[model samples]
Target: MKSKGKVYLVGAGPGDPGLITVKGRECIETADVVIYDYLASPALLKYAAPTAELIYVGKKGGDHTLPQDGINALIVEKAGGGRIVTRLKGGDPFIFGRGGEEAEVLAAAGIPFEIVPGVTSAIAAPAYAGIPLTHRDFTSTLAFITGHEDPTKADTGIHWASLAKGIGTLVFFMGVKNLPHITRNLMDNGMAPDTPVGLVRWGTTTRQESVFGTLENIVERVRAAGLKAPSIIVVGKVVTLRDTLKWFENRPLLGKRIVVTRAREQASDLVKRLTDMGADCLECPTIRVAPPEDWRPLDAAIENLAAYDWIVFTSVNGVKFFFRRLFETGHDVRALHRLQTACIGPVTAETLMGFGLKTDILPENYRAESVVDAFRGQSVAGRRILLPRAKEARPVLPVELTRMGATVDEVTTYQTVQVRDNAEMLVGELADGAIDMITFTSSSTVQNFKALLPEGEPLERLLNGVTVASIGPITSDTARELGFTVDVTAESYTIPGLCDAILAHYQRL
Candidate 1:
């Protein structure tokens, strides 16, 4: 007999993907079917298994992809099919997310279910806007009320008089549209017209916007700002604390949409750093790293490791692929016991160290020229050296080393092929002026990204106003040669340095 399936009502948390709880992520990872809402960060969808059937039941203002009743039935059907289902909702599922109704339906259907609580936007939005719901000196009472209650009901479920006189802090979800009604009811119930009010839209995310005023003028302020729904409204003296406690809004790269052109496998660190600094990163990997088609060259070189006196690694990919192939070929780090290694960058050196080998020479600058300069001090006359790196890598290192009387056997450990799957979408985004900046981490990324662009439009016109950032002078030169006007180039050729350069570029603006 087939086992019974379970439905997990998971809270996806407010905007930030990092805010998701461990259990919530686990549920998403293990689910066979995932139903997600509009407010749930699309970034969180990365947690879902690739084979999982993803369904978007996002409801915006009055536009819902699927009605509540239909969603309820869909989850039941998926669960009854013996598939593990995860209903991913934004914020706390139980707090005004209609999750209670869904749970009731699940219970009625006799389906086993679990509730994974998320960080509700009610508190999270106010906090991100620097407004604490309750401060000991300000007030101890807090109440969460729905801003968009049922319109068919004859009267509001909220007791205006009790809220005005009893509560110290009031947070209303989905209240931007009902701002006037909310303010009028509070004041009519004897609440002060001058009570502090704050509205946070797209809170806890890079697009967060905050508007502040008093109950008397807040509606006008929101109107002037043209703020729309999906906003949280805060009413209390605690709203005044925002002026000093504001942090998320002040991030240097906040709201900047940056495109990362590094390989997806290597782009995570850069993406995390940029996201942490408040940039919305789009991982449009221009190239993907793969093993060389013919491993005979690397294998041949590895088989006679004792013949080489030195080994040089160009990048982290080179080090990783070389070691991976080395291990696969039944040889360990001990095979290189006699060879002294030279690495181009600190990251490559660190990766090499992970394989129980420390680089003898680490260049001050992370480039081919720097590697050549580092080797100038060593005795290289008649020395045999092994070079394992990308197939499309520059010939500068081998040429320079050969000039120094060193016999360098260059072998391809990895190949970086152009990725075209997201090319059309990227071109559309670029044409629509949705991208703020595009970052190139290597010469290949610049080359492949240029190749991904369509031919009819002038390259300059297509990328007009889009700031171009490069990891180093080489990559910048590649971009410039391809008709791109480079705006930011990292002083240091590293991911963190690239992020810092992007931040500094915005700071100057």
Candidate 2:
């Protein structure tokens, strides 16, 4: 007989992926199988190993799903087969999540299990809406009550009339459908008809929405607002704090739709940071970098490295592709012996440094002009300069080097080709005004954005109400020439600075 494996009953927290506890994330990463409920955010599943099997046991209102018996049996069967099973639920599993029943079954089946506590929705949902459950002036006591009960229960144990006066604040989970009945019950039981109430839907996620009103009008207001299920209802003086405590919606890029035009592989960090700052990010890769069409030029450049006095790299891709060719040609960083190297920016400089070649000149400010200034007043009449760069880069460096009387050899180190197909989903989203902002990291991105989009709907008009943010002046200038107003520009050309710029803009507004 196979040894039974231990089971982990984990709470996934509210809908926000980040709200998941450290313990919950650990179990999810190691579990052989994950059984998740509907309320748990689907994003959490990405943390599990690719080999782990994911089983969905979520039940929506009035929807038939895996019965409790079957779910419990599946857990036991998997554990008995020596599999580590994770029962993932939204919020604290033991609190109104029917985790008690599941635990009972596991215990009866002799399957050892551990319960990992979660940030219960009862607290998280209200807190996300900026409502504190307890306050000295409002009320010291708070109560959590389920608006629904088991159909076959011997009695509806809760006394509505007594509860109306027993607690200072009342939080109702799974109560949106029965809002009318609940409101009437509270009022009929002597609670004030005008007590403040707030409904938080999709709490803790980017889609979170809050609707506030009095007990007498909240039902009608929520209906008018089209509030859906998976919402929490809070009724008490604490609900009044939302106006002052609300901060999430006020983030710098909170409602802006931004477009990211970097390669998909390199865009995740920037996209995630922008999204976390409350901007809706649209990923559309305008330029895809690939190995050089032929490495002869780069190979020759590496062979004659010492013949050049200066080697300039304009982008990180140039450094990467140039070195890749060097290695392929049986050369190494030693090939760069006795040559002064200049990088246009920190990113390029860091890439070169990674290959054990420290940059001799990195501009304090990252720009072509700053690079030119770095070598100002230096004699170059007899010096040989080598430039390994992208095929379509600007002529500024070569033109300036020629004017400086230096013998410059500019060779293409890599190729940047356009993506043949436009992302239909991104286009559809743009057409429907679903986007909030568009971020351009380069002039190429701005130009490509226009190229991918339909002609008549100029990028400016397509982004009429949306904000256009750029990483620096060059990208901002490209956006301006294309007739789109630049909304935010980072003080520094980096992702963190871009996020800070976006946040500062919103904070000032």
Which prediction has the highest TM-score against the true structure? Answer: 1
Candidate 1 lDDT over residue span 408-471, tens digit each = 9999999999999899999999999999999999999999998999877898789888999999
User: How well does candidate 1 match the true structure, expressed as C-alpha RMSD?
Assistant: 1.3
- Model 1 clashing residue pairs (backbone): none
Residue 343 CA displacement from its true place in model 1, Å: 0.3
What TM-score, computed on C-alpha atoms, does each candidate reach?
0.98, 0.78
Q: What lDDT, from 0 to 1, does candidate 1 have?
A: 0.93
Q: What is candidate 2's lDDT per residue for 395-444, written digit by digit as tens?
A: 88888878888988999998777773656767787778887677787787
Which one is best on lDDT?
A: 1
How many backbone overlaps does candidate 1 show?
0
